[model samples]
Target: MNDETIPQITDSHCHLDFPDFEGKLPDFVARAAEAGVTRMVTICTKLRNEPNVRAIAEAHAPIFYAAGTHPMSVAEEPMVTVDQLVALSAHPKFVGIGETGLDYHYTSDSAQVQKQSLRRHIEAAQRTGLPLIIHARAADDDMARILAEEHRNVPYACVMHCFSSSADLARAALDLDFYLSMSGIAAFPKSQELRDIFAAAPVERILVETDAPYLAPPPHRGKRNEPAFTAHTARVGADLFGLDYVDFAAQTQQNFDRLFAKAAQYKAAA
Candidate 1:
């Protein structure tokens, strides 16, 4: 599609500070803008990295950020607290609370620690009224149970970031008004099972992401993924939904706006 017809896109999730693009970030950012990505959310996976993440967001009018620790590292030194997360998120540019949740794919030995950390992150999300960015892999049942258990006391919006779990889990999140974000993995040929879930999800609940410096879609598969590559995932989603690229892009942008309501501030300026 031409620049005029390419719908303005928002990468609801990405790590702009990831080492892959550190020295060449400006060029990548320029290319992403040229590719029609109007806004992006730079996710912070560690409280210590929140400053760098926030700085990136602060430096770019179109970039927003989140504050929370990755579940895999929760048991490590310098654990994050609800107060710290709340404080870090006070910045006008900070709009969400995570990159949090269980990741059994990497370390299944500490399931309890992961669960506890996820609870803390969820609590922070509730305390701050910001959406949670969940990263669940190979632990859908446990993630669902924990989310359901905490839903009563710490109700808050959520996005199953980089969703690669079962359709049942997606249904549970949607039933709770949580959004589901699709990353480049959704565009992989081996991910047809995942695409089936996306195909069945409500368009209003679907958001697009690149999860950059990681999960680059086909053709770009082996290279670093970036916000500019989000368009491909959007294209794949649009194709699965039987809609044209423009319409699909518009729908995902709308989904991003509604899910991360604070994003509207950046969108308006864009």
Candidate 2:
């Protein structure tokens, strides 16, 4: 396919506000745009640094943001209340509600705290009418149950970001009209099951992400990840679906727009 045909993607999750990329984010974002990454959602891991996350989004027209504490980081600082999340998310640059959910992978003792935090974030999502960017690790059952119960009455937009869970969880999320975004982990040799899940996922519900400065896909695994490197994830997804890189990129880009609905408006006004 020609350069014009290759989709201009959105890095659905990244951390431009992280300390490691502070002074160097401009160049990193620029390089990503040059490589056809037209938009990115800089995820927030802490509620206190929301200003910093918003600053990055404000600096770049193609960048958007999500506001909420990560499950792992929620124990750190000023606890984010549902009201606070709703108010903070009123900013135009703020497009979604979370990197929030259950993660028992590392700290199993904090399950209750994470669950409460997840509920607060879900309430914030319901109040704000915004999409949610969820992070689920070893707590797939809890994740699915919360989503199912919470969504039954008040259906809200949500994406299971950086998914590395069971097929049952994947189907449950999709059944909730929640989008499933794949991260660089899908590119690993040990992740064939993940690739199969990606292939079986409805195209409209599929999105591609980097979860950058974290999961850097093959050839760059264990190194610092960035938005530009998300192309490797796109390549991995394309290879899974038996499509060319550009085609798969286009498909996932469309899914990203639909999942993060405000992104379309952001792009339109740009």
Candidate 3:
């Protein structure tokens, strides 16, 4: 397809602040624009790194950001307060609350701390009205339970980033009106089951991401991933939902506008 004919899409979560892109940010963002990726939400998983990550977004017109203490870093970093996170949201380009949620896959030892951090982020999301960017791994049960418990107290919007979890957890998120962001993992040829999970989801509740500097999709699977690869995963999403590239791209773009209202308004006002 020609560049002019290609529909735009958003990479809802990524990590461009990591060393993997050191001196190549402008080139990386240019490549993403060429791929029809008009916007990206680069996540700040640790509060201490928020300034650096926020700088990257501020420097690049195409990039927006979110920040909070990541679950794996919960034990290492000082606890983040809801006031601190709400203050971060005051920045024009700060769009979401976290890459925070449960991640027992590697950090089960700090489950207690992780849970506390997750609630703190959830509270911040509720207080700020920004959609929570979640990262759930092997702790599905706790993830579901805590999210539900928190929602009962005060509702907040969220998206399960890089969703490769089980059907039950997917249902848990969907039941709570949360979105599911498709990543390179779902585009792997061996992931038919994961494709099926997304296929069953409402088209309007879907978003796409790269989580880059990681999860590079096929043909580039073993290599470093970047925002430009978001289109590659979106292609797989089109196939999963039995739609053509343009239509699927439009659908997901509308989905992103609804969930990331701050970014939508930022673009409109800019």
Candidate 4:
């Protein structure tokens, strides 16, 4: 196929800085380009890792980045202040505020600390005018409550990264004009119910991701994921939205543009 005929998509969330692909980011990004995944946002889950994560984004034109203390590490890392996150956002490639939110499944013991961390991240996003990247796990109720509560305090844009939560949480996130990011898990055959939720959502409110070095889509399931696999999940998204590959790809890029405007604008100016 002619390269120009291929549609473009973005991997809204990934972790290219991790050791899984050490010394091989250029090759992985090349693979993503071949797959029509022309862009990605590599998340920095710890402040201490921000420099390295930012380097990854700086090293490749197709990449952008976000940073915040992940929920699981809330207790282990020093608590982040809103001012610190706000300061980081001043960087040109720093596109969002967090991979933060409540994750009760494995780290329920630190729920209170997680909430405090989440609130602080939310404040940073609010003050910086950047979207918040949320990671919701088994704490849907609290997650929903806190997100809604935080919005009431001060509104900010966000995307429920790798969203596979219940319909209630989906509804809550959507009601706030936030977005739902589709990941490899949504393409799993047994995830009919979750797919239904995406089908029920507005196309403009949906974004596609690989959550790379994590959830690889079908045909690559049970394998280590990378931004390149985002194309596979996006093909599934096309099916759910009842659109062709090109149209679906266009719509998602537009949705991503709307949610992560900093990334879109940065790319445009480049």
Candidate 5:
């Protein structure tokens, strides 16, 4: 299909600054546009890499960014402060607070520090009025508890980026009016369980992503991923939701604009 016929969508999460896309962002962005992925949020997983990630966003009009010390890196990197994250939000293209949350899959040993960092990012989200981008793994209990607990203290928006978690965790996030981002992982053949979880969610709360440099969905599975492949994952979401591709795409666009209001405003003003 041509661009006008292809359903336009946003890759609500990705990592354009990773070495996989080094010196090749323009081509990737072009390919994404061709695939009808009109916008992308490139995530910064470490505080030190914020400048590089920010530069990627600054260099590409279709890109925006979010930064935080990822749970896996919490022990190795200095802990992030709410003030530092709030300050970064000053940039027009800095759109979200984190790719933060608990990840017991590999870094379970640093649970305490990860929790501390997650809370700080949550506070930053609270302070900046930006959605907190979360990366939850095998730590559903703690992740849900902390997020719900903190939301009670002061409400903040969030999206469970690249979400492939338990139905319980999904419900917890949805209960707090948060979003669940569907990545290429949900398009995997064996991801029926994950798809079922998403199928049970409110369509208004669903978003889509590529999580580029990883989880490239079928046809490109086991290969390096990119924003262009977001369409593959989104097709899966459309099927799961029993909606036509265009309708699902439009739903996600509305969901994205609602959660990432800054990026939506930027596009409107442009």
Candidate 6:
């Protein structure tokens, strides 16, 4: 289909600063636009990389960014402070607080530091009024408990970015009025269980992403992913929700606008 007929969507999470896209961002952004992925949030997984990631957003109108010390890197990176994260939010394109949360899959040893970092990111989200982007893995119980506990202290918005977690965790996040971002992983053949979890969610709370350089949906699976492939995952999201591609795309755009209000406002003002 042509641009007018294409169903526009946003890649709510990605990593454009990764070496996989180095020196090729313009082409990737162009390809994404061509594929109806009109906007994308490129994430900074380490505090030190925030400048590079922020520069990418500053250089590309269609790109926005979020920064946090990822759970896996919590052991290696300096623990992020709420003040540091809150300070970063001053940038017009700095949109979210994290890609934080628990990840016992590989970094189980650093659980305490991860938890500490997660809370700081949550507090940053609370302070900045930006959604906390989460990356939950095998630590669902702790993840859910902390989120629920802290949310009770002072509610904060969040999205389980590239979510491929348990139904219980999904429910916990949804219970707190948080969003669940569908990445290319949900489009995998063996991801029926994940799809089912998403299928059970309120459509108004669903968003879509690519998680580029990883989790490329079918037809591009096992290859480096990019924001352009968001349309592929979103097509599957449309099918799972029993809605036409355009309608589902529009719904997700509405959901994104509601959650990432800063980006939405930027677009509106532009």
Q: For each candidate, give its TM-score against the true structure.
A: 0.95, 0.95, 0.98, 0.99, 0.99, 0.99
| Higher-ranked by TM-score: 2 or 4 | 4
Better of 1 and 3 by TM-score: 3
Give, for candidate 3, the lowest lDDT window spanning 10 residues: 1-10
Kindly list the per-residue Cα lDDT of model 5 for residues 232-267, writing each as its tens digit. Answer: 999999999999999999999999999999999999
Instruction: Candidate 3: list runs displaced more than 4 Å.
Output: none
> Model 6 over residues 133-165: C-alpha lDDT tens digits?
999999999999999999999998999999999
Candidate 1 to truth, TM? 0.95
The 0-to-1 C-alpha lDDT of every candidate, in the order given, reads 0.86, 0.86, 0.95, 0.95, 0.94, 0.95
Which digits, one per residue and each the tens of the lDDT, describe model 2 over residues 104-183?
A: 98867788888888888999899888898899999988989999999986889899998889999999999988898889
Which tens-of-lDDT digit does each residue in 2-55 have in candidate 4? 667789999999999889989999899999998898999999999999999998
Can you tell me which runs of candidate 1 are displaced by over 4 Å? Answer: none
Indicate the TM-score of model 3.
0.98
How well is each residue in 93-135 modelled by candidate 3, as lDDT tens digits?
Answer: 9999998999999999999999999999999999999999999
State residue 149's C-alpha deviation in candidate 4, in Å.
Answer: 1.2
Which is superior by lDDT, 2 or 6?
Answer: 6
Query: In model 1, what is the error at residue 241, expressed in angstroms?
Result: 1.0
Measured over all alpha carbons after superposition, the RMSD of each candidate to the real structure, in angstroms, is: 1.5, 1.5, 0.8, 0.7, 0.7, 0.6
> How well is each residue in 82-142 modelled by candidate 1, as lDDT tens digits?
7888887778888898888888888888788788778878888888778889999899899
Backbone clash tally (model 4): 0
